[model samples]
Target: MRKGIIGDILHGEAAYIHDLRYQMKMKTGEGVWRPYHLAKRNGNLYPTHGLGPVAQYMNLARTDDQFNTIISYSTPAIGRNKYAKKISQRKTYGINRF
Candidate 1:
C-alpha cells in the first residue's frame, strides 16, 4: 500500500485545504504588501497565488480530475484599518493619505 505524505495525498479519498494567510505589512515606505483599496476593489487580492501548489499536488489538468469551479470570499478589512491607524498615529508608515 502507498505510504508517506505524497502517497497518502495521492491515495486519499478526501483532502483538506489549508493555507497560511499573508499578513499585510508595510515595507519601509513602500506601503503595505496588499493594499486595502486594491483588495476591496478586487474580490481576492491574490486570487491564484495559492492555487498553483495545490493544483500541482492534485495533478489538475494532468489527470481526469480537474477544477470545475471556484468560490471565493473575503472578510472586511478591519485588521488593515486597525494596523493603518496604529502606524499612522506613529507617523512612520509614510502614508500621508490612505
Candidate 2:
C-alpha cells in the first residue's frame, strides 16, 4: 500500500511562522525593497506554499506517479513600486526611511 509522494512539505509552513514572526526585521523592510528580485538558498526558495496543494490534487503517489524538484516564480513588482513612486511624486512627500 503506497502512502504518497515521499517528500517533506512542512518547510512552507515553518518558513511562514519563522520568517513572518522571528525574522521580519530582515525579511520585510524599507528602502528599495523587492521580493521576487532575489532568491534564497541560491534559488527560488518559496515554492512549497504552492507545491503542497498541487501534489495533493495530482496524487503524485501512484505506482507510476513521480515527483521532481520544486519550482518558484518571481512576480512583477509594478504595484508595489508604483505605490512608492506615487508617494515620492507627491509635492509634500514625507515618507519614513530606515
The number of the candidate with the highest TM-score is 1
Each model's lDDT comes to: 0.50, 0.38
Model 1 ranges with Cα > 4 A deviation: 1-36, 89-98
Which stretch of 10 consecutive residues in model 1 shows the poorest summed lDDT? 12-21
Q: In terms of lDDT, which candidate is strongest?
A: 1
* lDDT (tens digit, per residue) of candidate 1 on 1-98: 22255454643233334321223345533245335344446356455566766676667778797879865566665555555666555433222334
Candidate 2 per-residue lDDT over residues 1-98, each given as its tens digit: 02446654443221221222111123345322323232112334565655566555555655466666555445643444444445454221112210
Q: Show the colliding residue pairs in model 2.
A: none
Clashes of each: 0, 0
- State TM-scores per candidate: 0.50, 0.36
